[model samples]
Target: MNGLDLGVVGNGTIAGLVNSVGNYQWLCLPRFDGEPVFNKLLGGGGQFDIWMDGLVSRSQSYDTNTAILRTRLEAEDGAVMEIIDFAPRFETRGRVFRPASIVRRFHVVSGTPRIRITLTPETDWGDRKLPAVRGVNHIRFNDGELAFRVTTDAPVSYVLSGTSFLLEQDVSFILGADESLTDTVDVITLDWEERTRQYWTKWARSLAVPYEWQEAAIRAAITLKLCVFEETGGIVAALTTSIPEHEGSERNWDYRFCWIRDAYFTVTALNRLSAMGTLEHYMRWVRNIVAQSKGGHIQPVYGIGLESDLTEEYATHLPGFRHTGPVRRGNQAAEHIQHDVYGQVVLGVSQSFFDSRLISRPGIAEFRQLEPVGERAFAVHDTPDAGIWEFRTIAEVHTSSAIMCWAACDRLSKIAAHLGLPDRATYWSERAAIIHKTILEKAWNPKVGAFTASFGGDTLDASVLLMAEIGFVPASDERYVATVDAIDSTLREGNHVYRYKTEDDFGRPKTAFTACTFWHIDALYRVGRVEESREMFESVLSSRNHVGLLSEDFDPSTGDLWGNFPQTYCMVGIINSAALLSKPWSEVI
Candidate 1:
C-alpha cells in the first residue's frame, strides 16, 4: 500500500519507474540492446553523467499519444520550468507510442531559479576503464574499448566516479547552482530546447487518444517501442537485464534481446494506437523469422537488430544490483523452443486485423503468411516443449502450451475464412477441439478441480488463469471458477503471483510472474466479476513504480520491483487488461 521504497530499501536497483524531479536514474545509451551507459537506478549510478536537480516541485505525464514525459519543475525560489523527454517513434508502426529518443529540454517559465546538474556514466557496468581529466567537462569511458564522452552542464566538484574506475566502474560529475562552473560545460542552448519543444508539441497532435488516461498509455507504449531496435524491428523484452530476483538469489537473466512471444502483444498494442510505423518494423522482424525456415515455427527469442550472436556473458567487472551476483548481458536462451510463443505471435497479428481501424499495407502483407506458419505449429502441437513460464528446469507438457496451440489454430482458421483462403479450416477446427479436450482431461485434477502447472504436477499454476483468456474454457464453466479459486488461494501470496514455488528438476524455483497476475484480472472480468476485477486491476497498478511502469515481479513487503525493468509482457498485460476493462460486457469480456 505504501509507495515503492526505491531510494533506501531497494537502493541501486534501477528506479527509473519510481523517480521524478528531472533526474534520469537509468538509461542505456545509443541503443536499447547495447550495454548500459547510464544505470543509476540499478544502484550507485551507471556509465553516464547526469546533472539535473533543483529544490523544485515536480510532476510527470505524457503529452497525448506520444511517449514523451513532460516534467514541470517549480523551484523553491519561485522559478518554474518544463522539461520534455521523448524517444521519437517512426510512423512505420501504428496505434502505439514511438518517440525516437529521450530528449530533455529546460526552459524558465517564471522567475530565474538555479538548478543543480550532475553527469555520470557507468563504463561497462564496471567493465570499462575511466580516464580522469579526459575533458574539462567530460570523461572518456572504455566500454568495449570504445570511447564514450560523458558531458554535462554541471561543475566537476569531486565526483564519486567509483573506486574501481580502473576496473571500468561508473562515474559522475556534479553541477551546482552557482554559475562559476558554467563555462566548463556545454550548456544546451535555448534555441535547441525551443526547437525540441516545437517538434514534440507538433508530434503530440498527431496521436489519436480518446481519453485523459490515454497519456499514460501513450508513454507506456512508446517506452515499450523504444526497447525495439528500428533497424531490425526486434523488440527486446526490457531495457536492462540480469538484475537478480531477490537478495542473493541467482535468477538473474539477460533480457536485452528480442522475444518472439512479445511480437504479438507489441503489434496488437501498437496497432490499437494507430502506430503503423512501429507495427510494420516489427512485422518485418517477424517475416525475417519466418524466412529462416519458410515456416511459422519460432524460437522463444532472438538477437536484437540483426545481431545473430546472443551468447550470454557474465559481467565480472561491475558488482550486480545491490551486489546480487551473475550480472549478464546477452540471452543464452535465444534458441529455446517455447511452444506457447506460436500462439502469442498469432494472437498479436490477428488482433491487429480484428480490432483496429488502423492498418498498414506492408503489415498486412506480412501477416498473410500465417497459413504456412500455422501448419508448422500444428506439426508439433502435442509435443513437449519449453512452456510459457520459461522454467530452467526440464521441459513439460504444460496445459497453457496446448491451449496456446489451440488458440493459434483457432485464430488461423478465422483469419483464413476472413481472407477467403483455401486453408485447411476443417482440419484446424478438429485439431483444436482435440487439444482442448486433452488439456481438460490430462491437465485437470478433479480433486483440486483446477489445471496443474504441468502434466503430472500436483501444484496449480497461475497459467490456469489464462484458460478463459484464450477461450479454451468458458469463463462461466464450473471448472474455470474453481481454477481461479485455486490460483487465488495457492498462487496468490499477498499481491505477488508466483509461477510455482516448488523446485523443478533443475533445482530452480520459479519466481513470481507479473503477467500472470494481470491475466488473473482478465479471467475475473470474463466470469462477470467486474467489480472484483476492477479492484484487482487497481491493486496491480499500485505495484507499478511512480511512473506507472512494472518489472517482472514486485516484492510484496517493500514494494521493490524485482527482476528486469519496464518488462514487455507486463506492459502487454496492461494494454490487454485495459482493453477488456474498457469494453462493455456485450462488446468484450
Candidate 2:
C-alpha cells in the first residue's frame, strides 16, 4: 500500500524522500545522481524506519515555510512521538554548508513511547547490501566507493538489533559523511535544526508570492528549490526515478537528470516568486551546456554534472515501483531529437540577458553564442522529431515543438534588441515570423476547430494550450478560445486533463499529466473563465499529497498520485496556477 504520499528533504546537494510513516524510503547519497542508499520506495531492500509499538494514527507535514518535515505518530496507549527530518542547510563560515546529509530528531510528546529503529542501506540500485562497521557512537556503512556514517545518541545495539526501547529522552540520528561528529549529538543537532529553520524562514520571507494560496506557492517553491543541485546549478526533474507514470503501464523512466524543458518551466515558476537564486544557478548550468555544445545539437536531458550520454538501461536487479518491473537507470530521451529543447534552452537562458539582479549578465559573447541555437531552432521548426511527449516509435512535427521553436526565435529577437543589435534582432524576428506563420497554417486543423498536436492531425493536445501562454496566440482570439473549448470538451476529465487521447508508444495515457492540467487551468483563466478556472485550480490543489507535494501524474478516479515523487513539473504547476488565479495584493490587503 505504499504510495506517493511522501515528503522530501534536501540541502541542495542531496535529497531524500520520506514516506508518510517516517521511513527514509528513497535517498541518493553524496549527490542527486549518486547511488541510492535507501531504495524501498522502488520496492528495493534499503530503508530507515522508526516503528512505534501499538501505533494508532500518524500524520506528516512540513515545518512552516521550511523543507523540514515532522511526522507525528500516536500510539493506542496514548504515547505520542514526533520525528523531525531535514537535511541541514544554513550558512557557515564564508559559504553555505549544504552537505550530503540528513538529520532526524525524535521527540517524545507523551507517555513512555517504545520505539524500534531500523536502518539498512543498499547499493547498486538495491542490488547489493552495504556492510556496516560499528563504532562506539556511530556506524559506518561502506559499499566500495560509496560510504557514509550514521552518528546517533541512541544506543547502537538497539539500532543495529532493531530492539524496542523506551524513548524517555529526546534522541538524534545524523546520517552523513563518514567523518565523526565534533560535539554531542543533542547539542549539534539542536544547533543545526535551529539554524536550518532560520535559514528556510528567512529564505521564504523573500518570496513575492500571490495574495491567495500563499502556503501552496511557498511549499511548491521550496520543493522546486530542493531539486536543484547546488554544486552544478542543474535542476532535477524529480528526486527518485523509475516510478511508473501509471501502475503496470511500464512507462517508468529515470528522471534524475535535468531536462531543458522541465528546467525552463521550473525557473519560470520560481522566477515569478522572485526566487532568483535558482534561476541564476540554472542559467549558469545552461551556459555550460551551451558552451560545451559549441552551437551544435543539444540533448533534451543531461546529468546534473553535464554528462551527456544518458543511455537508458534496465536495472534487472531491483523490482520497479509497486512491484512493476523494468527499473530504468537512465533516460533514452537524451538521444531523442527533441527540437523543442532548442527553444527551451534559449527561453531558460533568456532571463540572464534581461534580469539585472543577476551577478553575471550575458553580453555580446553570450548573445553571439545563442545566435547559433536560434539558427538551429529556425532550421528545425518544421522538421519531424519526438515531440514534447517523446513518443518512441512515431516521429511527427509536433505542434508543441514547432511553437517552442518559434519561442526560441521570438526570445532571441528580443534579446538581440536588448543588446542593441538591430540587424541581428531583425534577422531573428523575421525568422520567428516565418515559424509563426507556418504554425498558424499547418498546426491549426479547421476540421477539429483547434490546433492539433502535430501538423495536419485532427487530435487534440493539452500542450496546444501553451500557444496562448507563450504569446504565440492571443487568449481572446477566436482560434485560441475555440482550441481551449475543444480541449475542454475532449481531453479534460472533470478537473483532470490528459495530455492527449490517442494511443502512441504506450497504449494510451491512463492518468492525467499533472502539469497539463495546470496549463488547462491557466488557459481557462486567460480566456476569462475566472470562476471556472479558480474552481478547477482548487480541485487540483486538493490532489496534492499530505505534505503539499505532487507527482508527475494523478489518478482521477482513485485520487492517487502516480509517476515520479516530488515532480518538478507538478510543483511548477502549483506555483504558476496560484500566481495566475490568486487575487491581487491590492484587492486582498
Candidate 3:
C-alpha cells in the first residue's frame, strides 16, 4: 500500500491521493497545509471510497498526459466499473477553475456492477467524524471551520446508507466547498476533464526530456509539480507526513512544510527538463523568504506562505500509519539553523539572472538583495548548525553545509560577472576560494582517506558524495574518489544508501534514503563507473512502486517504500538520474 500504487491529482490549490482500487486515502483540504479530509493513509481515519463490495480484480492507470486516475474494478459476478478521479482544474475564462474539489465519475463498463460509496470525512486529525446534513441535491458535512459539500446525481439516500446498488449509466460526484452546482455534473466534469488533459499534455510536450527513460522522468516530473503550493510558490518535501522513514521508528515528522534545501533540489531537477514555470515561481518564493529573514538568518524549513515560527506538535488522537502513534504536525526543524540553505537559495536564484528563457530575468536589484545571503553564507560556513539531516539534538559544522557555502559564493561570482560587476565578482570569487580551502583543511581526514561528515570529525556520511556534484571537488580528484569509496564502504547496504549511521534523535536510521541511493548512482557515474552506475540506477528504478513513484525512505531488504508519499526529493532523484544516464536525443531518431 505504498505510494507507488496510488495516484495524485492536484489543481495547484488542493490535491488528493487515490489508491489503485479507487479510495481517496490522503488529502489536505483548501490548501496543502490544511487539516486532512481523507487521512486513511495515516491509520484509523476516514476515506472516500467508491469500491466494489466483493471485488475480484482491479486495474489502475492515469489518463493520457494528465493526472486523472482511472481504476477498473471487477466484481465476482463479472460486473466491471471504471472509476475516474480527478481534482477539477482547468482554465475558466481568465482564471484557473481550481476550486477545492475532488470530482469522481463512475461509468459502468460491463454487466450491472454493485458499487458501495463511502464519503465519511473526519476532521481534527480523525479525532471525530463530522455531522452531515442531507440536502435536496447535495450532502453537506459541517466540521466547524471546514465545511464541505458533496454534489452528485447518485441517490442521496443510497450514499448516506452505504447501500450497494446496480450501476446503469454514468454518475458524477463533486466533493468541494459548500456551493451550489449551477451546471449538470456530467457536462461540467466532461469539460473539466478534457481541458485538464489538454493542460497536462501541453505541459508534458513542453518539457526538454532526454530520449531515454522519458516516461519515468515525466512521471517524476508530474509528481514533483504536484508537490508545489502554487499560491505561495512553495514546494513541500512530500504530500503527507508521519509515514515513518522506518516503520514504527517514532521518526515521523510533518514534511508538508517547505524545506529550502529540498525545494532547491526540486527546482534544479525541473530546470533540467526546461520546466521554467516552477523554477520561476520558486525563485520568487525564495527571494521573498530571504527578504523576510533578519540579516539573512534563514531557517532550513518554512511554511508554504513564508510563515516562520512553525511549532512542532503531535496529534496523539490519530494513529499513525500501520498503527504507529503520535503523528506530528508543524516541523520543529523550522527553528534549526541549517546554514546550508543560504547556499541553496543563492544557487536556486542565480540561474534565473543568467538564463534567457525566464520571463522575469533578475537584474542588479536582485543581485544586490542576494549579496546579504552570500554574506550570511560566508559568516556561517564555519559555524555549528543542524546539518542537512536535521538532527534534533546535534549541531556541528557539517561538511555538506560548508561546501554549500562555498558553492553560494562560487555561484555569486558567476552571477556578478554576468551582471558586469567585476569588483563584486572578484570579491565573491575570493570568498569562495577561501571557503573552499578552509573546507579541505578542516573537513578532510587523512587517516580515514575521506572527507568526514563534520569538520575535523572522523564519521563518514553519504552527504560527502555531493562533493563532485556541487563542484567542490572534481569527480576524478583523488580526495573525491576516496570520499566516494569510503562512503560506499560505510553507507552502502547492497545497492541502497543510508544518509548516515550515526545516532540521532531517534537513533541511527534503519532504512535507506532513496535519494541517497540516486546520489550514490550519480557519483558512481561521475567517477566513471558507468556500468556499475547504470546497473545501480536500474536497481533503484525497479524499487519504485507500480506507478513509477517513490517515497522518502525504503527498507532495502524488503524493498518497501516508507516515509512520506511521492516525496519531491525522491522524485527529483528519478528525473535527475534518468537524464544523467540517458542516451542523447541525437540517438532518438
Per-candidate Cα lDDT values, in order, are: 0.61, 0.92, 0.87
TM-score of 3: 0.98
lDDT of 2 at 518: 96
Model 3 misplaced regions, further than 4 Å: 2-4
By lDDT, the best candidate is: 2
Per-candidate Cα RMSD to the true structure, in Å, reads: 7.0, 1.0, 1.3
Summed backbone clashes in each candidate are: 48, 0, 0
**TM-scores for every candidate against the unseen true structure:** 0.79, 0.99, 0.98
Sorted on lDDT, best first, the list reads 2, 3, 1
Mind sharing the TM-score for model 1? Answer: 0.79
Comparing 1 with 2 on TM-score, the higher-scoring candidate is 2
Give the residue spans of candidate 2 off by over 4 A. none
* Alpha carbon deviation, residue 241, candidate 3 (Å): 1.3
Q: Which digits, one per residue and each the tens of the lDDT, describe model 2 over residues 49-121?
A: 9999999999999999999999999999999999999999999898888988899999999998999999889
Residue 217 error, candidate 1, Å: 3.1
lDDT of 1 by residue, 88-143 (tens): 33233343323222334454567655544444445666554344345565444543
What range of 10 consecutive residues in model 3 has the weakest lDDT sum? 1-10
